[model samples]
Target: MKERGQQVDQNSESFTFLGKGTDFKGVVSFGGTIRIDGRVEGEIHTTGTLIVGEHAMIQGIVSVGVLMNSGKIHGTITAVEKIQILKPGVLVGDIRTPVIAIEEGSRFHGMCDMGAHLGSGERALSLDMAPGLVATAQ
Candidate 1:
C-alpha cells in the first residue's frame, strides 16, 4: 500500500483553482497539492501542499501539511511541516506550525508561538490549553 502522506508524482498533472475573479464560500478539503489563485471564505484542510497565489485572498482557517502564501489571509493556520509567506503576503491571524519562513516585505498581525521547533510540532490550542497534537501532562 502507498504510504500515507506520500508526495504526489511531481510529473503528474496537479490540481489547481483560479479564484482571482470568483467568490468561494464553504470548507475545502483535498488530498494532493493545490494552488489557489482566487478567493476563499471558509476552512481549508489538505494533506499536501496548499499554495495561495499572489493575487489570491483567503478569509478562514487553514490546516495542512505545507502552506505557502503570496496573497492575503485573515484567519488561523495550522501547518504540520512548514509555512512560508513570500514578499507582499499579508496575514492577520494566529499561526501554529513547525517551520515558518517569512519574506521581508510580508506583514503579519497576530500571535505566534514557535514552540513547534522543539520537535513536538504541536501548537497549544490556547494559552492554558494543551496542544492538540500531544498528550497532556497528568
Candidate 2:
C-alpha cells in the first residue's frame, strides 16, 4: 500500500504549479496533477489529482479525481476517489467523496456525504436539488 502511494506521488510530481504570491479568479480545467500555493477564486475541474499546498487559499467548486489539501478552501468539493485534509488545513465547504481523511489539527465546517451510492448517477440529481428537496428524496 505504501509503495502504491509512493508511485502515485511520483506520477503526480509532473504537475503544473500555481506558485505562491499569485492570485487567480476564473475557471481552471486541467488533467494530471496541479499544485496550488497561492490564492484562487473560481471553479476547478480536473480528471486527476489536486494538491493545495500550505499557505494556499481557494474559494470555488472543485471537482477532481483526488484532493490533497493542506491549505484553506471555502467552497464545495467533489472527489471521485478521495479527499485528504492535512494538519492545519481548513475546509469550510460541503464535501462529496468516496473516501475522506482529516488529520489532527485540521478544521472543517460543512456537510460531508460519503454515501456508497454516489457513483450510481443518482448523486448528481441530489446535488442539483435544494437541500430540503434532497432530504425528502432520500
Candidate 3:
C-alpha cells in the first residue's frame, strides 16, 4: 500500500502530520514519513523521512534518514541519506549528509559535511598494488 523510498506520492502513505499552530518540545522519533507545519523546540530523530512544511520552525538537533525542509531550522541536522531544502526554506545550522539539494529560493547558512571518508570497506586503489603493466609493475 505504502512505500518508503518514494519521494512523492506520499498521500498513499500513512504519515504523521503536525499541522500549523501546533507547538512541541523535547525529542520526537518515528519511522516512515512525517510532516511538520508548526513550531518545535528540541530534538527530532527518525529513521524515516521528515518533511518540514513552509510554516514550520524547528530548533535543536535533528537526525533522520532523509529530510525535506521548506521551513526554518536552526540547529544541527544529520541525515543518513539525503537532504532537500525546498523554496523558502531557511536552514541555519550545520548538516551532515551524503547528498543534499538546495533550491534557488532556499537559504542555507551553515557547515555541511558530506562525509569526509569513503564508505565502509571502500578505499582508493593504490597504484603500487594495482597492475596495469606500467613502470610500477614488478
Candidate 4:
C-alpha cells in the first residue's frame, strides 16, 4: 500500500551508488541486488533489487525484481514486483509493474500498466498505463 506520499519498507534491501565516477555500456544480467552508481547504456535484467543512484544515469531497458530510482532513467522499465521513485528521480519511459511508488518530488513522464497478474507463467507486471503491450516484470 502507498500513502499520499511514496514510501517503501526500509526492511527491504537497500542499494546505493556514489555516482559521477562510474560508467557502463552493455547488457547486464544479475541476481541478488544491484545498485547503479555511475551510468548504464544497455539492457538490464536482474532477479534482485535495483537502485539507481541520485547522479547515476541509465539509457536502456531494465527488467528487475524491485526498483528504486533516485537518478535519471531514459528507457523502459519492467519490474516484477514493485517500484519506487525517490525524490528528484527522473524517469522518461514506459513502466510495467504491479506496484509503483511515485514520490512527490520525482519526475516521471511516461505510461504505466498493471496487467501482468493474469498469466499462467511467472506473474509479470502489467502496464495498464498503455495499451496492447504485455511485459514480464518479475
How well does candidate 3 match the true structure in TM-score terms?
0.77
Considering every candidate listed, which one attains the maximal TM-score? 3
Pairs of residues at least 3 apart in sequence or in different chains that clash in candidate 3: none
Which is the winner by lDDT between candidate 1 and candidate 2?
A: 2
Listing every candidate in turn, what is its Cα RMSD in Å to the true structure after a full C-alpha superposition? 10.2, 9.2, 8.4, 11.2
Ordered list by TM-score, greatest first = 3, 2, 1, 4
Please list the C-alpha lDDT of all candidates, in the order they appear. 0.80, 0.86, 0.86, 0.79
Alpha-carbon TM-score of each model against the true structure: 0.74, 0.76, 0.77, 0.72
Q: Candidate 2 has which clashing residue pairs, if any? A: none
After superposition of all CA atoms, the RMSD between model 4 and the true structure is 11.2
Tens-digit lDDT track of model 2 for 1-105: 010011234544556778788788888888788888888899999988999999999999999999999999999999999999998899999999979999999
The candidate 1 region of ten consecutive residues with least summed lDDT is: 1-10
lDDT of 1 by residue, 42-88 (tens): 99998788998999899999999999999999999989889899888
- Give the poorly placed runs of model 2, Cα more than 4 Å off: 1-14, 116-138
Give a tens-digit lDDT track for model 3, residues 28-111. 877788899988899999998999999999999999999999999999999998999999999999999978999999999999
| Candidate 1: regions farther than 4 A off | 1-10, 117-138
